[model samples]
Target: MDDLQFLDIFRGKLIKLTLKTSSYVGVVQRINSNKTVLLADVVYVEKGIKVPGLKLFFGHEIVNVEFPGKTNSGDRETLGYKLEDHLLVEEFQPYRKSIRLDDDEDDEVVINFEVIDEFHGKFGSAVMHIKKQRLIGVGADAVEAFQQGRLCWLQIATKNKVYLFDILVLGAQAFKNGLSMILENKHILKVIHDCRVISACLLAQFGVRLTNVFDTQVADVMCFYSETGGFLPDRVSTLQEVVSLHLNVPSSQLSSLKMKSQLTKEERELWYKRPCPLPLLKVMALSVIHLLPLRLVLLDTLMTDYMDLVDSYLSSSYNEPGEVEHINMELASSQAVPFFAAGTMQWRHTPRLDLG
Candidate 1:
């Protein structure tokens, strides 16, 4: 069989590529029309370390292709290499567990919860404590409710504690107390995942703008770009997916939490209900619990591998001047220009000059 044909068979599957100088292992992303193979999540076979970005390999440069499982007579005759003999057994283990932050047995995550529903003396202290912190993980619940013109809860996680603020109960008064300042402060770093929706909700509903944001989702994309020198725009990851990838949260634990937290359309109506259940609140707490640690891990990778992009990551803010302002300014400038007579050369020349 043709080499290109063989490669096409394994597109989207994990395989090892034997080159003249070195070998690499990765999942087949695409095979270009020119016979260049693109691989994602590539790993150096000998070193057992992941190579950051997508890797492209020319068809002629490949000496042999090795995939898992038994080798048949036809494969041995056509390839002249025993697939079973050169299988990447020991070399592939590290790649499988490279992104795991912890061991399988050490899957416990502890969160210190502080529920602030009432406007009391403790509420003032909680606000003060949060304001004093330099870094906090911000997460919001009932976002679906907020989108549908209902209220939501905001959770803030520091190194020692997680504050569950009842936006439904305190309403705008919560922001007046201290939450607004904490979000708008430029000095304090807010670690949030995919801040677009939450930021919009905060701005539209409460008039609070998010500043000095270290968006974990954006950071993850940047890290991928730094490692592989490319971007996959369609591959925007969710918070749960990001946590499982970077933090190595066990699959069993994630599955259990997911099972417990799965809600139907009818169940989603509970977001507007008063006095939310303990189990549901715990589900809300999970949103921000791993954000701080996740940010730290991603930042360390960015600082070490791509120091230049670190500033870009830290400076991500939803409060920046929007595109609408720029568009309006352009419209105003265009409208200010005087129109010339249609018969004159100046009329044609003006449009050409503007184009130039």
Candidate 2:
């Protein structure tokens, strides 16, 4: 509802962003103990772009969700995945140099007496300036004009007050620089501690929890969210493991591994012929891929199981009328199939076609 209320969700938890450029979005809600609902609002895509719509269906209601846009992939970028791959080997990461984590530093620059008195009552004033506090007048509105992420948001006595501040950088990297400043500061640990408290409070406020990627079982941890209980512990895997791990069983072994059926042949034939699945199915597929570990099963076994899981998840949705069906079905479609090129287009259509 209110942005301040959202702060409650982040009060005491740690925000694990894949990149410094990213800002956290999404409000946590609950329909089942198994998972928390996250609503994404105020997406930060680009000046003229908009994110696609997302929706969830309850008994007779459909809930629309908006996710905030990210400045970067955060941790994923740090890991050198995709476009960030080239950056991993570089010598100058944002963390390589000085950092500043002081609340004093984070504190508003004391407005100069002259400017403070001039703006007092008339406009309400707060300066987010990196300028000398002795200045006659300065305020958060000034800092915001430059879009300083480090400043969060500058508040004056009045919300309508306008102050002037200049941005140190032009775009996403500016946010990174701001966060890096926080990371490198000598007081970083303290700020981080504060961030944790803030995160935890936020989660509790939003009725959600912030999960540590490492604590959750996963090989290559990309992203995660915690509602009351939105997950299953991943297989104990580390970043080192994700980077180096591969299917250990020899290709010869795969011949012996029978792929399990996911959808029944009827369903499979129907899905295979489609251009793309319904969004609900896609989300379900993502849940399956993220939560299920059968990706290592022999291709044959994988195929069979995927068919079974999908069919069950789909058929069961309407089975119990008005039951408020809420399920977290998982699919291991990606790891179960080999990659191939289809004409001019290249796609990783795991047996079930891994779109994400």
Candidate 3:
């Protein structure tokens, strides 16, 4: 079925959707295809952040949608919870300092271009010259290359179309198994591991010690489960359900984004005898492409709904008389549970046991 057709079925149902600028969790109160209009009962921000007033949610503004539970299967009705957005923080102003890039004030150059990684080797010398000149590029892996003391791919997860200037540094202080702290419980880990590549990446990239680990699933569960009688053994929420409940997205679209390889054993065997399908490669790429926007939506929800909760975890001490220590020692120490160890020689081939 064309995915757009699901919108007709979604009418009167609850959804979490990501608008161009913000996120919302609401019910599809009205959908007039003739008028090209959509109206939703906005109950949640990030599907967890509660705010006042009903708002207009345009179909074009919707970047993604999720449907929670099994409404199609007649299993449940309604989206489940009410919620909140971020609390405000105090403002401060400081005199900024300037530093010269190089000794020669007359030597200045600026370049703007986008390069796909497929052509990375072709532009190797040009990129090296730019790095030597300390020139910055805006697309994707450029800034990451500048970091880690090398202008090349590292053991880090691939970041797509990221602007280095737009990056937000959460903090400097490190935490052990910090991913687990935001993950909350074991069931959440299993759910993400089952469908999403996030858990595996976290373990592979950071191992136990990590900085600024925030899992959106944790925020969603806290918001939804708290209002709907908390977590029960049989009622664990999936990523789709959480996104649907919090982001105002629909499940049908989420399923499409997942793009589960439906190839059977016979089909797989047949495909192995020939060149892989181009559509299959595109489908795989789409899976990763869809995840980036979803991550942003989840991050927006987490930061908005739990700013205070996050602040409470930070340290109250000062690094110096004027500089405050923002590291959260208590929070960091709390996450000292076993986390996956990816590079250990003994466990390299072991699929099940990597926790250390």
Candidate 4:
């Protein structure tokens, strides 16, 4: 594969790209057959800046493209240009898995879990493969478990340097946090940061239209409202509350489970700084582990109250009739089966499945 292709490596990253005639900076929207497209949010010029809706640069016209990390010049001239109206984006609908009968594939499948925590400014995402009560993590401590073949079945993203998993952008809300954080209290920033990363992980991609993937908070809300059958008093619940209610694990026990770390207040300033202490890793690791038990109880709850949850989801009236129809289509095609790569998984008798 052409790993160096600017379109492939930095497909979704915000970039400062220099063309032969002018320099433009924006999010790399997509890489089509012939052109590299950008949502040209900002245009830099000698006198001032401009906000052009969308700009496309031919593959050959692009002279050079630089990512933020590589550009250390610290030029103030290049950055986000303030726009009058920001885009209002809708929440990403959760992916649904579909089942198909294929002799090559087995109906029995392994359960995969991932948890992401934000420390300092960086994201720490942990992955685990579970089957028949066995859990194998991808980390230094989990190596022995892997050697024992506990994780043998997992179709790991890595193979011949190309990762099968691709990063999928769930919503623009994830990118809009900075403005909201300034209005909110700094004390809560850490909590907000943690929650955002977790939300991102829920929407993270291993394969296209990932199935059996969930956010603990979303699952909890569905289960809670399904049981109560009313509008949620609190749209979002704290992680501690979900743990207490669903897993029957209290916050105090979770606190005790975290390993002790030597990180001082000064060092704690940069939580992602390595080597990440054992205590911090333990806490991060525990968050992933907690999801395991939570999934068990919540999954059962969801199945029992599936219709109630559907009613709750559909109850929200959309402004446009087409919008409602679109949601119905998305919900109808969603599957709950184990998801692998896009081509490997196929929906059998999709028309019958959707109608049902």
Return the top candidate by lDDT: 1
Q: Per-candidate TM vs. native?
A: 0.53, 0.15, 0.28, 0.30
Better of 2 and 4 by TM-score: 4
Taking all chains together, the TM-score of candidate 2 against the true structure is 0.15
Model 2 backbone overlap count: 62
In candidate 3, residue 81 scores what lDDT?
Answer: 21
**CA lDDT, candidate 2, residue 184:** 28
Candidate 3 lDDT tens digits, 308-351: 65554443332254566555433323232212244221111112
Residue 56 of model 3 has an lDDT of: 66
Candidate 3: what lDDT? 0.33
Q: Per-prediction RMSD in angstroms?
A: 26.7, 28.7, 23.9, 23.1
lDDT of each: 0.63, 0.25, 0.33, 0.36
lDDT of 4: 0.36
Better structure of 1 and 2 per TM-score: 1
Q: What does candidate 2's lDDT look like per residue over 218-327, in tens digits?
A: 22221111111223222223212221223232223222111212334344332221111233122222111211121222222324545766777778776865663566
Write the candidate numbers in order of decreasing lDDT.
1, 4, 3, 2
Q: Runs in model 4 with CA error above 4 Å?
A: 1-212, 256-270, 306-356
Model 1: per-residue Cα lDDT over 278-303, one tens digit each: 55566666677678778878887778
Better of 1 and 4 by lDDT: 1
Ranking by TM-score: 1, 4, 3, 2
